[model samples]
Target: MKIVDVICTPGLTGFYFDDQRAIKKGAGHDGFTYTGDTVTEGFTQVRQKGESISVMFILEDGQVSHGDCAAVQYSGAGGRDPLFLAQDFIPVIEKEIAPKLIGREITSFKAMAEEFDKMTVNGNRLHTAIRYGISQAILDAVAKTQKLTMAEVIRNEYNPGAELLPVAVFAQSGDDRYDNVDKMIIKEADVLPHALINHVEDKLGAKGEKLLEYVKWLRDRIIKLRVREDYAPIFHIDVYGTIGAAFDVNIKAMADYIQTLAEAANPFHLRIEGPMDVEDRQKQMEAMRDLRAELDGRGLSVELVADEWCNTVQDVKFFTDNKAGHMVQIKTPDLGGVNNIADAIMYCKANGMGAYCGGTCNETNRSAEVTTNIGIACGAKQVLAKPGMGVDEGMMIVKNEMNRVLALAGRRK
Candidate 1:
């Protein structure tokens, strides 16, 4: 197959205004979106309000032409300006990079991938994003062209995908464990009168201390589970890393806390999600090393998964070089593109570390599906469920796709 054309689809960016009222009013439902007044009915209620850019990959072989597509929905975070992405990132794929791919023999994806990197020089502003879109489209093209299942192509190219069972550890800040009572109520009950009451109030309310209490309640509940339970199996915990106690829990305290939780709950592993402030690559590695040393000293045997620091490939290499982390959490959009992500994963696996592709709260299902496919294709050990388990509808989409992929791999058998 040869590249015939590449197109960009433009639209407004979307903002997600969740029904805080519903969440405040109702109890949680299957860890997905809660049902109640304030919350939107489902995922579609999550809307795009501003402009967005979508790129389509058009390919031709002999007489046939078909399109493969990728889209980037931009939004700002942490009070920062809208991350000036898309346009800055897309051209790297549609212009500078796509032309080189046009007449090349399409048999070797690895070779094509190498060429794409060399041609772009890896320092382009949109290198990661563009490569991601381009790589995703190309992978689809290659799979379609060869008539091979995506899983088949991936397995042939790299290691087999791991059986992924992701667990959720709600991000909370503080001492009170039961902070989000509405969500708790929704999760545990089928119907709630309180949801109606809160929904009427019209403000999505979350008391910081109360939220902490809710998280503590959740943590304590999980801590109550045995290593091998008939019901709640030992799984993983994702700490958005805010403990009501302190953000910087000393190494000993942090180690002690992890060991306590690991012993009590016997989780498969613990992933500390972030907002850690590491000024440069060296400091980042030091933080990882420090955490690793503490874990080793405690003899906890829990793996430290890196998210905040492993934002780029140089960061990944730094982590690998300094013996920092046991695993890496890769956010596809954060990294920019599929090829760059592939390089990161390959770097991890080839150097004897594991990779888990992370998901976001804001991703649409279409994007979620593509990430899952890429997670397997790129050899990530596990993939996080998106839209979170709190949004029942979105969770269902993620769970269904994840289950389908797992079933294809005969994980249940």
Candidate 2:
């Protein structure tokens, strides 16, 4: 099929873009918004509504294939691309990208996605958000031409031998950490309560006491409320580097504290993400490696996950090569094209590292569904239920999409 036309439309994401730097610097919360000056560049406020652009390709047969271009919530931080305002990028798509896409043959998704993903303007590559969305459209277009689901297309091109199965779902509890746990428990999320523990003094406590208490509470709550004893979910919390700050970045101290958390979680497995962000990619990897070694030396079963500074396929391999963390979060949007997400997941799995197909809550439903399909195709360890902080909506979107794809693939088989 050939692309007959291209269209772009500005839209709002399910969640807001939060300035992670500003929040870490003690920007107090004020009724769903922050109360401080913005620290991150391109952020007019400490918090702002997230933006996305829907890129639609008109196939020759009158079928429309589309994807949403969106960025992470913590844009312009951790060496990522600048803020993605729809107004600034829509024209770039209409003028620069549209012409190139129009009249192109939709033959191979891998070839077309790589060509545009690496294409540059003004001596720099296109924004990750743009590459992300355009790649989704390309995959959708190819799938339409082949009369196959997106998941089938990926599996055929990337991992023909891989099984089409439902990846485990991980749910996040943005700020509503307490109430959201209840929702996650009811839904039986495989990974429960990505408690957004970002602050040092307030969330993690000066000596890491607050987080300890929360972990104990989370364990008890699960044991008390779960209908079945077998409904045990992994406790995966994103501390956003607060644990390192609390323990002065000492590997031994961090390891000791992590052990305490694992004990608090009891029978449930514990995975701490972004334990420490040393602010440099190399330093972050080294710190994670040392910490993982420390935990292993002490016979601790807690897992460490790398998030910050591990933004690209190269970064994923770099971290996996060094054993930086037991798992690497393949942040979908940060990897630019959806093709890279598949590459990252396959690399991690091949290297004996857990691949968590994770993305920001500040994304559109289309982006979440697309990444979920890719995650299943690549056999990621866990797929994040995302696009919002609220548990129910994100869970519904991710879970339903996985079921539909799996059902279709099963019927075909």
lDDT value, candidate 1, whole model: 0.48
The TM-score measured for candidate 1 stands at 0.64
lDDT of 2 by residue, 223-290 (tens): 99999999999999999999999888999899989999999999999999999989899999999999
Give stretches of model 1 more than 4 Å off.
Answer: 11-52, 61-105, 121-127, 160-216, 219-249, 260-270, 350-352, 377-379, 387-390, 403-413
Best-fitting candidate, scored by TM-score: 2
Model 1 alpha-carbon miss at residue 64, Å: 9.5
Candidate 2 global TM-score: 0.97
Candidate 1: how large is its RMSD?
A: 9.4
**Model 2 CA lDDT for position 161:** 79
lDDT, candidate 1, 1-413, per-residue tens = 76676666543322232433344355355442344333333223223222335555566754332222222222233221233344554555566665666665566455555555444445634334345445555556666677654444554565455433332212211112233323333332111111111111121112223322333444455445323343232233344333212335355655665565455433333344331335455775677678777777766756776765466677776777666767777666565555566677777878767676664454445455656665666656665544422444444555566557656656433
